[model samples]
Every structure is written in structure tokens, then in C-alpha cells.
Target: MKKQIFGFKCAFKGIIRTINSESHMRFHIVAGIYVMLFSMFYSFSPTQYAVLVLLITSVMALETVNTCVEDLCGLVADRYEPLVKFAKDAAAGAVLTVALGAAVIACIFFLDFNVINTIFTFFAENLLYLIFLLISAVISAFFVVLGPVGIKEKFIKLKNRHLTKG
Candidate 1:
């Protein structure tokens, strides 16, 4: 029993490491959080919630698997190899397919065409708000590309350099 519990703990640690190391995993996590928050705004039936849970779990799990596969491929070849390329590409393709499927499912379940149109219309009418939204998106993209910790480290380095110059 202790061994089983330890194994589960180790598995969870791996999941955490993957989340920290992989930008796409972090993006998926953020997206999942947003989806859960958005879901609360709607009165989803139990079945719908269950479906959402399943979809979220599958996408996250598949992404973790892809990370593992990519890591393994990297280990298998320090330099370029066709087999490694195929393995990495295949893993990425799997993740992309699942992510796309999840997006379609989300749109079908949560978004209406009219709602999308209204969003675009509102942004069009409110150009300043749209500019702010775009800026926020760019910041988010930077944060996602460089993990939060990486961004903090860069900021700290810049600050220290300026202090030394002064």
C-alpha cells in the first residue's frame, strides 16, 4: 500500500514537472482554468459537465504524454535522426488533433454564433477596448512563451544591471 501511494506521488511530481517545463502544458492549464470559470457562468446539466471534465482530462493527459514522448525522443538522439523526428512529430500531431477537437467541442457546447458575432461587434465599436484586449493578449503570449519564472528572472537581471550602471 505504501509503495502504491509513493508511485502515485511520483507520478504527480512528473505531471507537475511537465507543467512547469512545457509551455504548451502551461497554456493548456491556463486555458482549462478559463474554461472552468466560463463554465460556471452557464447552467450546464450534469451530463454536460461530465463531458467537459472528460474532454479537459483527455487533452491534458494527452499533452503530458506528448511531452514524455518528446523528452524520450530527445534522449534517444542528441543529434537529428529521422526516427526521432517522426516520433516527435507524431506526438505533436496527436496533441494538435486533440486540442483542435476540444476547441470544436467547446464551441459547440458553450459558444453560439450570435455570441461570437456580438463579441466582434462590441470590439469593433469599442476600438480602445479592443486595443487593450490585443495588448493583454500579447502580454499573455509573452508570459506563455517565457514561463512566468523566466520573465521574472529577466526583469531581475535588467534591474540589477541598471543598478550597477547607476
Candidate 2:
């Protein structure tokens, strides 16, 4: 039982590590949060929510798997190899395929011509929320570009440097 629990812990750690290391994973996470939050504003049926959740997870899981595959390939082939290149490209292609499918699913499930009008209407009246959303998006973009792990590592290095100087 302890062994199984440890295995589960390791699996979760890998997932977290992937999210911390991968900028695209961070983007997926931010997009997923936005999807769930925005869905609250719309009267989505439970069925729609279920489908959206599945699609979101599918994209995220595939991305994680792709990362794992790329890492594995890199480990086995230290030098540039055509086989490794093909394997990495294939993993990336899998992610692209899933992402494209998810986009189509989202369009079918979540978007409509009226959604634009709804957004404009809401922003026209709720200026504060719009500003908040813009700020949130900018922050999210930073996270996606720098990644959580990168930011933490930089902060730690800065702190250590300051401590040494002090």
C-alpha cells in the first residue's frame, strides 16, 4: 500500500514538474482556467461542461505526454539523430492535432456570433471588470513566457545573491 501511494505521489510530482518547466503547459493551464470561469457566465448545460472538461484535459494530458516523450528521447540520444528528431516531431504533431481538434470542439460548444455581442455589451458596461481581465491576461502571459519554475529559480538566485552581499 505504501509503495502504491509513493508511486501516485511520484506521478503527481511529474505532472507538477511538467507544468513548472513547460511554458506551453502554463498557457494551457491559463486557457483552461479562463474556459471554466467564462463558462460560468454562460448558461452551459451540464453536458456541455462535461464535454469541455474532457477536451481540456485531453489537450493538457497530450501535452504532458509529449513532454515526457521528448525528454525520454533526449535522454537516450545525446547527439543529434534523425530518429530522435522524428520522434520529437511526432510527439509535437500529436499535440498540435489534439489542440486543433479541441479548438473545433470549443467553437462548436462555446462560441457563437452572439458571443462577440455579449462580450462587447459586458465590457461596455463593466469597465472595471474589463480592466481587471486585461491585467490578468497580461500576468498570465508573463507566466506563460517565463514559467513558474523559471520565475522561482530567478527569485531564489537573487535572494541568495542579496544574502551573500549582506
Candidate 3:
């Protein structure tokens, strides 16, 4: 039991590290969150939800694997080598393929005109929620572009600057 718990803990730690270090992973995470939020506007069968979950996980897993491959290639090659480049490209390509596949799945599930109209009506009815959604979008944009570590560093710098000013 303890060993299993440790394994889970390590897995979480690896995910956290990857999110901090890999911008692409951050983008996928943000996109996944948006997908989940949009999904809330529609009712899905349990099996459909499960499929969505699987698709999300598959994208994340591929992104993590790609990160690992790129890191390993970096370590193995001090400078540019064609084989290392090929390995890195292949891993990235796998991630892209999975992500695009998920997008296709999303389109199949979400591309109904009635559903799109319903989503628009929902936002139009709930302006406060729309504001919240906008705020979340800005935050998600920052998260994907700057990353958590970059955001923390920026906040720390701002705090220090304010302290010096005061």
C-alpha cells in the first residue's frame, strides 16, 4: 500500500514538474479545462463522458511522453544531431496527432447549431458568468503562455518593487 501511494505521489510530482517546465503541456491543460467547461453546456451520457476523459488523458500522456523524449534527446546530444532531432520530432508529432484527434472528437460532439445557440444564450442570460468566463480566459491565457513558475516570479517581482517603493 505504501509503495503504491509513493508511486502515485511520484506521478503527481512528475506532472507538476512537466507543467512547470513544458509550455506545450500547459497549453493542453488549459485547453482541457476549457473543453470541460464548454462540455458543461451540454448533457453527455456517462459513456460519452468517459470517452472525453480518455481523450483528455491520452493527450496529456502523449505530451508528457513527448517531453520525456525531448529531454532525453537533449541529454544524449550535446549539440545538434539528425537522429536526436528525429527522435524529438517524432515524439512531438505523436503529441500533435493525438491532440488533433481529440479536437476532431470535440467537433463531432460539439458542432451542433442548436448547442452553439444554447451556449450563446446561456452566456447572454448570465452576464456575470460571462464576466467570470472572461476572467478565467485571461488567467488561462497567462497560465499557458507564462506558466505557473513565470507567473510566480512576476508576482514576486511586483511585490518586491512595491516594497521598495513604499
Winning model by TM-score = 3
Residue-by-residue lDDT tens digits, candidate 2, 42-159: 7789988998899888889988999999999989998999999999999999989988988888777677768757877897899998999999999898799888877788889999
> Model 1: per-residue lDDT, tens digit, 1-166?
9999999999999898887688998788778766875676566899988988888888889889999998898888999999899988999899899899989989888786665576678779999988986886677677678877778898999999999999
Cα lDDT tens digits, model 3, 66-155, are: 888988998889998999999999999999998999999999988989989999999999999999999999998899888999999999
Candidate 3 local distance difference test against the native: 0.91
Model 3 TM-score on a 0 to 1 scale: 0.96
Between which residue pairs do clashes occur in model 3?
A: none
TM-score of 2: 0.87
The C-alpha RMSD in Å for every predicted model, in order, reads 3.9, 2.6, 1.0
Estimate candidate 2's alpha-carbon lDDT, on a 0 to 1 scale: 0.88
Q: lDDT rank, highest first?
A: 3, 2, 1
- Kindly report which residue pairs in candidate 2 clash with one another: none
Error of 3 at 53 (Å): 0.7
Best by lDDT: 3
